[model samples]
Target: MSGASNSGAALGSLLRQIIVWVVFAAVVVVLPHLFTSGSSISMMSQMGVFILFALSYNMLLGEAGMLSFGHAVYFGIGGFFTLHAIRAVNDGVFSWPLELMPLVGGAGGLLFGIIFGSVSTRRAGVTFAMITLGIGSLVESSANMFTDFFGGESGISANRVTEVTLLPFSYGPQIQVYYLIGAWTVFAALLMYLLTRTPLGRISNAVRDNPERAQFVGYNTTMARFVQFALSGFFAGIAGGLFAIMFEIMTASNVGLIQSGSVLLMTFIGGVGVFFGPIIGAVLITYMQTALSGFSEGWILYFGLLFVFMVMYAPMGIAGVIVAHFAPWRAGQLHRLIPVYALAVVPAMLALAGLVSVIEMGYHLSLAYDPSQPIDLFYMQVNVTRLLPWVVAVVVLAVGVALLKWVSGRIRERWNDINKTTERPEAAR
Candidate 1:
């Protein structure tokens, strides 16, 4: 009876997992239909690419406890190689399906990961991070030196629509490209998720938590880390390949510090503690990058402020905060915190509005200052040359901050109440 019940439970778990994946695929398929625009399709494709890249980074930082500042090395290398492959196909030098080109990029990344991981994985922690950074710098510098391959500053370009596809349709359409990226994104996500259930994945986690103990238990911690790093490179390379296909270009910047930093920001802001954290992070950050940059020159400033806020106040990230309420939800105590959250949001929005006003005025003064021109603030023309608007904005910001501080205390108290109530049942059991 016990064995049968265990088997039944396992079957149910598998069924639930299948349903979740199906739903995820459904959402990916349905999204393009809802947002039927060329730019939206393009933006979603970029999101899909970053989602894979961020998830791969999470495999190192979150699961294997290896923080990488140079992960983009693999991404750029893979992209360049993939573009070269596409060029080869376009030139009649080879006949291959473009759909499988990302695999070639994966192979390139895996090869380099093996080459680099052997040395970098020798030491853990800051040493490993610094080594990766150095390696990235070396590769980036080599890009200019190897002009034939790297194309110097112009970079490499290729045509993805080489009439080499498994389907009858040419992948020239943005929607088609979106589907290709979506397919790979789902495929890579599943493989990464499955990796977490494998022996290497478990050993990687062990090495992450306590390298000494992992070594004591007859596991080569360095080897496990190397494997994890290489696999991460493989996935990152896949993202790079998709990037090549989508943009038809691979440049030095793709493998530079900025690209590496962008992925790091995505993974960290998404909450490296959870599997789906990077997904949320990638989607949100990508939207901000694509949308917010169009509206203001200070979007980078706003982005930085957001990162700082997440690191300081919500270290667990957006997903982590959402996950934290699950216990209370299960125990029927979540409603207690809803009103408090609603109360807090009002002051938060007001504070954000005031902050935006100040930032916009500052940008107007420094970037495109003109006494005759008025900057738009909250849908109204505001003269930065005047003092009253500044004073009003400052006052609003001050008031909002003060109110938010007071409300936060109440929020804390309510959370304490909910946590206690939920824990009592577990304690009694």
Candidate 2:
């Protein structure tokens, strides 16, 4: 009876997990129906691609505690080769489905991973990071130098619709491509999640937490790191393949320093400690990139500031902040935080407004196509060249900072009081 009960419980848990995944997949598939815009579909497709990229990166950061500066090397290599594969199949070299091209990209990444991880995994921490960075720099430079393969500064482009398909998918439509990306993304995410439950994954975590202890326990720390790095590269390559297909282009920039930094930002800002943290980070960052780029030339500045704020205050990323509240919520003590949170919001908004105003004004004066163009903020038009606007922005910033400092203290006190009260019973028990 006990064994049967345990089996049933396990089945029930499995069923619940399947249901969650099914609902998520359904939402992804139906999103285009709701949004119904060409740009939205394209944006979401990029989100799906980055989702895989970020999650693969988290395998290093969250799972293995290895910080990589050159992870984009795998992604870029995968993408560049995948573009070649597309060209090859198009020229009647071989018949292959577009659906399986990502595998080729994965192979590209695996090949590079084996090559690079062999050298880099011997050293841990900053030594490993520097080695990876150097390797990345070398590869990126080679992309330009080896123009026969990389196709020079313009990059390589291919038509994705060249592959023969049974499902009437030309893959020329953004929505059709999005479905492919969405399906592959979910499949990849499931695989990565399952990897976390494997013995290798468990040992990877062990190595991450305490490499010395793991080594003492007779596990080869360097080998463990190599395996994880290789796996991460594989998934990242898959993401690169998707990027190649989506844009129908591959460039040195795809595997360059800028992209390496972007993925790092995504992983760190999403909550690098959790399994789904990178997914959140990817979605948030992708949305920001797509949505914010059109409005301001200084979107990068705003994005960087937001990331800095998250790093300083949230630390665990957006997902971590949400998860942190779960204990209080489950204990029915969440109501206690409502007033404190409300008090914090005013200063937060003011701070944001003041900061945005200053940034916009600076951009307008320094880089706007016409420096004479007035800036708009919260329905107010401000002349950036005017002294009055500068004074207003400075004053607002000073006041907002002062108010935030005061409110944050009170908020912290309340937070501590609630946690202490809630945990008192557990301590007594």
Superposed on all Cα atoms, the candidates' RMSDs to the truth, in angstroms, are: 1.2, 1.8
Clash count, predicted structure 2: 0
Find the candidate with the highest TM-score and give its number: 1
29-99 per-residue lDDT for model 2 (tens digits): 88999999898899999999999999999999889989999999999999988999999999999887898
The lDDT for every candidate, in the order shown, is 0.92, 0.91
Residue range with the least summed lDDT across 10 consecutive positions in model 1 = 364-373
In candidate 1, which residue pairs get closer than 3 Å at backbone N, Cα or C atoms, i.e. clash? none
Give me candidate 2's TM-score against the actual structure: 0.96
TM-scores of the candidates are: 0.98, 0.96
How large an RMSD does model 2 have? Answer: 1.8
Q: Write the per-residue lDDT of candidate 1 for residues 183-291, one digit (tens) a residue.
A: 9999999999999989998998898899999999899998899999999999999999999999999999999988999999898899988889999999999999999
Candidate 1: segments with Cα more than 4 A from true spot = 1-5
Give the top-scoring candidate (lDDT).
Answer: 1
